[model samples]
Target chain A: MQNKITIKNLNAWFGAKQVLHDIDIGIEKNGITAIIGPSGCGKSTFIRCLNRMHEVVPYAKASGKVLVDDRDIYDSDIDPVEIRRRIGMVFQKPNPFPTMSIRDNVVAGLKLGGLKDKKILDTMTEESLKKAALWDEVKNDLNKSGVSLSGGQQQRLCIARALAVEPEVILFDEPCSALDPISTSKIEDLMLELKEKYTIVIVTHNMQQAARVSDHTAFFLYGKLIEFGETDQIFKKPKEKSTEDYIIGRFG
Target chain B: MDRLKLSFFRSSRSKLSGDFIFEAVVGLFALGILILAFLLFRELFIESGLSRKTFGLSFLFTSTWDPVNEIFGALPFIFGTLVSSFLALLIAVPFSLGIAIYLSELAPEKLRTPLSFIIELLAAIPSVIIGLWGIFILAPFIRDYLAPPLSTYLGFLPLFQGPMYGLSMLTGGVILAIMVIPITSSVSREVIMTVPTHQREAALALGATGWETTRIAVLPYSRSGIFGAVILGFGRAIGETMAVTMVIGNSPRISESLFSPSYTMASVIANEFVEATSKLYVSSLIEIGFLLLVISVIINVAARILVWKLLKVEGGKVA
Candidate 1:
């Protein structure tokens, strides 16, 4: 139950418009934390700020501190590239490198770091795919284009790609919203399994999904953290009125 | 009920005829292009019949380009076109690709649009003006400074051993390279932009540097398209006439040096077409035109085959 990430007074801006207000939350080690909110409530933006992905957009900026394992990730001395390697992100859509083979896609991160050892790459690709529950399906056709897979399988492939880097924390930006129910169930099961090894944070519009998979849930409303607590307490006995209204199918 | 069915049947019949007329008009418009190409080929062949009959295929092998004797061979012009265009591609491809990458990946938001527009504006200058500039500035600069050092240091090479004339194949190639940069860079920028955000995200999320993301994810996805852009620039460089004619010295010879004056098929046609008095002279020029047509066809067909082969090698992705 030790904290892995500590957010302190973070605010994000896209051009002149502020998208996230002052926010503070701590993500614990080896557990899934879900951020549930209405559309445009800054849930995704909040997570993106954790990995410094928000600043990639033109005119987008952020201020304040996000510390991972007691080290300030926002310090000027730290390289964003190094931070990203340690904290991987999986996008909502299945975004396998279209031109790369299944094996190449999994090992893309390793290649970027100049790891060209063929035996190590082969072993890592297999291990990562197995961890993401995709090895059995794609092992035979390792040379096939990453885009050739079914949508559900493509999502799994993307997960394997994220896993290939062996990150400390993995961010899922609504990873299963575009998936079917069966795929959703599989991903949910995978996340539950993944939390045993790595810190996980998910931004979800599905309250049920947050309730089903998260150990800690943070409810956001109008760029504010309305409630943050254990999932059971948040769902059964939220201290905030907004959290209760939102979880009970009241107004978003 | 019978009356309603009769009206419905009549309407559908008229709709079918309407669709047929629309389809036929578009089809005929497409057919016009083929017909025009065939007609142009026929005219060139018919007009060049004298040279074709006299020299047969040996016209391509011979280097004699005497107008008075009614003897002409396209070897020099062919060599000029290939060498100049090859050099142009060699110079332009890397330079333009750098510009393309800067625009696509590295340029700051405020600077990106204006810089790209300015780069594209280079294409708008008339080729005649470029040729004039080449004659006045580039030629003198090369003769006085660049060529001397090259010849002094690299005299062992035949290409550098020749006397430096300001107006030579090098000048023409450099001019062609300047002329072709805009098309390749702009098209390459367009190709690079087609790489989806998700693809970029996938790479960047893995802790890749900006350069690595662009190199591993963006470039590989758009490699074929960038190649196509280069080929398009090559097409422009090979067939270029006015600027090349003015600067190429209009001499038909096969020389080992870039400092030597040479001729290209298009340049020869442009320079002598009006003054060509003899039937055989016109025939030879027309035959050169035919040769140029054949060369372009071969290049395009080769590109098509290469693209197909790439697609087959990489599964179903676009080449």
Candidate 2:
């Protein structure tokens, strides 16, 4: 598989304590890759590192190369905003812009990107909602507040919002963790559909979810990438004893 | 028999419920305060009714305030109140917003707490002290230099005309502006600080610079709260008595120029309350107090409505 993102010897620190230690991983292009680990194992931190969102916390710092499509994303010359535009992220909680309407939420990144044309905004909003499989539910009430939507619909709306920016890659930080079983199934199906057009990376605690949706799975333990391979191999026959132990629920 | 005795003892171990009584007491305290406010309003309205025959709403429109003829109109006071407060707001908003933005978004971790305390301390200074400072130092500098040049160029406008007097509406407004700045800035800083981290991350991740993120995401998200802060400042300006009474010159007559002596509803009441001997005169003064109260309530209500509408539109989340 072609590499869409490459992280080489990446280390992250919060204040004096380092969290991610000498991590190196490559994300596949236009494929759904899953990151699975026990709680507090740095799965979320790894994804945030991709979009440079981890830097928001005071005293949080990262070192080493995080290259997106061969360009160093962490370079001083590169703007984080532009990087984020190309690589969109959906958080664990359904965070659609509260004050904006459903229609407005979808096109938020574009609006922030300075796309003011009404026609273009409308077209992008429709296309993004369609891509996220949420167009039908929200089309009638485009003017309704984004928060007024159900939890599942709001999550999909957030996905649509990320998609609206036409990002090359999409990151989901345990997107289904807060959702119901039905919503989880729907999002899983949507992820499969999205794999054809965009690079998708997801962090999940559900072993069954990783088996269901991911082309490749990266198993992490204690801020280290322990094993990474085809999902079936990782689940059925893992190389490391730790990876096997984790998948079988023997010990995390 | 022993088991039965132990069970009874366990069942009776629950604590007494005094929480309900405590809650009732607090509720009664709140009710008492509300009742006091209502009674004050009612009394002011009743006394102010004495002047209604001579001064209708026309009192609000007419500038002539003649004490000898017992003919009192509020136009001049209204104009002075509105114009000076408006001027103060114009100066205060940008300055306060800047201060708030700096404190909330820009200040380093170590500096943030101290700087915030300093700004809040400004709010603690008594209005009389501020008035004294405006009179002794700021007024002379403004009259001799700032007002003369500004009046020369902008005097064509009614609000900035006439001779540059040391004691005028301009002086009062400038002093009021300083007094009000802390209220606006501190509240706005708090509002801005309350903006969710995800919103800031969302904007920054989009590649927006610090300034752009603050401008587009943080500011718009907190617009309603900032507006509430401004209304609060307005309330302070309208009801401010000692500082305004000292510097506004307390001329009851209407004047177009900022340099001219003027009076506000609050200042008028404060200046004349001691000397007002007649029952009708006292009632009229009380009426001015009534007007000020009504104006403040209207402003506060309007601000609440706007803020409610603003909050409902967006889930208080910035995209």
Candidate 3:
């Protein structure tokens, strides 16, 4: 299988405080890989580095190589804008552009890309909403403000916006952490379905969720990856004692 | 319960406690302002009684201002104020928006804060200094060079067809435009910054350029607040007295040309306030003041209503 991304010897920091320490991992194309860790274990930091989103925060720096399809993303000549174009991100909260209509929100990414054709935009809008499983609910009120939707619907709308750009990889930074159980399950199912067409990486605190959706699991602790393997192997028979302790809830 | 009762007894309650005294003082302060407003209205009514008796409501419509026989009308002043203020907004809004966008989005992190502070400081400079600078420097330059050329091409416009006087409504309006820019730009910058980070990020992630992201996301998100800021700046332009009075030539006759000297309600009041010898003259000026106060209040109320309506459109979550 072709590897979608390769992160090698990755070390990251926020000012003087180091976060990720020598992390090396390869994620396969069209696969769902879950990064499971306690809060502040640098899982979110690691994902943000993939698309250079972490650089938005002040005093943040990262070293080592992150490769997407053999291109070194951190190379001096490589543009962060291009990396983000290839790898889209969804945040923990549903942040739809409140000023835009539901239909406009779906086509926002395309419009931002400078695609102005009305017919093309219409097709993309419908297709993106369908892929996000929000077309049925929002189709009637397409002209209403995106903020008028329920929280769960708004999150799905954001997902549709990301999809509209036709990115190869989608990174979820604890996307459903702010949703109820039903919304969470729906998003989980959407992720599984999404992986058939696009590579998906998810950061989650719930081990059961990691086992349920991800084909592979990488467990991080104290800013270090303790174990990485098949989901069943990582959960049931983790070779590292720390990984086992974490998976069994003995300690975080 | 016994301990609480003992503590309560130990802390003696006076007739006028700190909270009551503080409330009383603030209450009296608020009442003082209300009383001042009432007195101002009463005085204006008394002073305007002559104009009401002589010119009647035509005082507002008549353009001829003859102070020789004490025949005073405010049509020209009102017209000048509205035209100049509107022209100032037309020039200042786009310029201020560009400054705000540059300060908020394009400027480097090292420069953003300092540049923003500088723009805000321009707003604090006394209007007299700006007026003086306009009178000596800007007015002469416009009259000698720019106005003559503009008139050569666009003189067909009634506003541009006139003698190139250094001090006229156009010169005053341009000066007022500079004055209003800092207020409009700073308020707009604050509003634009409040547009959620995610909106910009979302646009950027889709391969949008920085300019593209701002155009699609930042501008739309802050549209209502920006409108409100423009109205507030318009209010400042309308009420600005010292600088406008100096540059506007204090002409009270109505003219079709912006290059002609004209006077605004504010400039008229300020120019005549110290020189009024007659009770009726003072009262007319006071009535002008009353009109200005009412106009400012109306602008503020309209701005608030627009903000409320915009919020309602945005899911009714008031800022």
TM-score of chain A of each: 0.99, 0.98, 0.98
Q: Please name the candidate that would achieve the greatest lDDT relative to the true structure.
A: 1
Ranking by TM-score: 3, 1, 2
Worst 10 contiguous positions by lDDT, candidate 3 chain B: B2-11
| Model 1 chain B: worst 10 consecutive residues (lDDT sum) | B2-11
Model 3 stretches astray by more than 4 angstroms: B1-14, B277-279, B304-319
| Residue B88, model 1, lDDT | 93
Candidate number with greatest DockQ:
1
Cα lDDT for residue B74, candidate 3: 80
Model 1 lDDT per residue over B1-319, tens place: 5323523224354555655566557878888999999999999999999999988999999999998888888889999999999989999999999999999889988898999999999999999999899899988887888899989998889987788789898888989999999988998898788777777877889988888888888898888778878887888898889888878777999899989898888999998999999998999999999989878877667655544444453322443
Q: Tell me which of candidates 2 and 3 scores higher on lDDT.
A: 3
Q: Candidate 2, after superposition: displacement of residue A217 in Å?
A: 1.1
Q: What is the C-alpha lDDT profile of model 1 across A190-220, one tens digit per residue?
A: 9999999999999998988999999999999
Best by TM-score: 3
lDDT, candidate 2, B112-193, per-residue tens:
9999999999999988898888889888988998897787788789877777778988888888899889999998898888
DockQ category of candidate 1: medium
Candidate 3 lDDT, tens digit per residue, B136-232? 9999998999899889999999988979779998998999999999999998888778777767776766667788889877898889888988998
lDDT of 1 at B75: 89
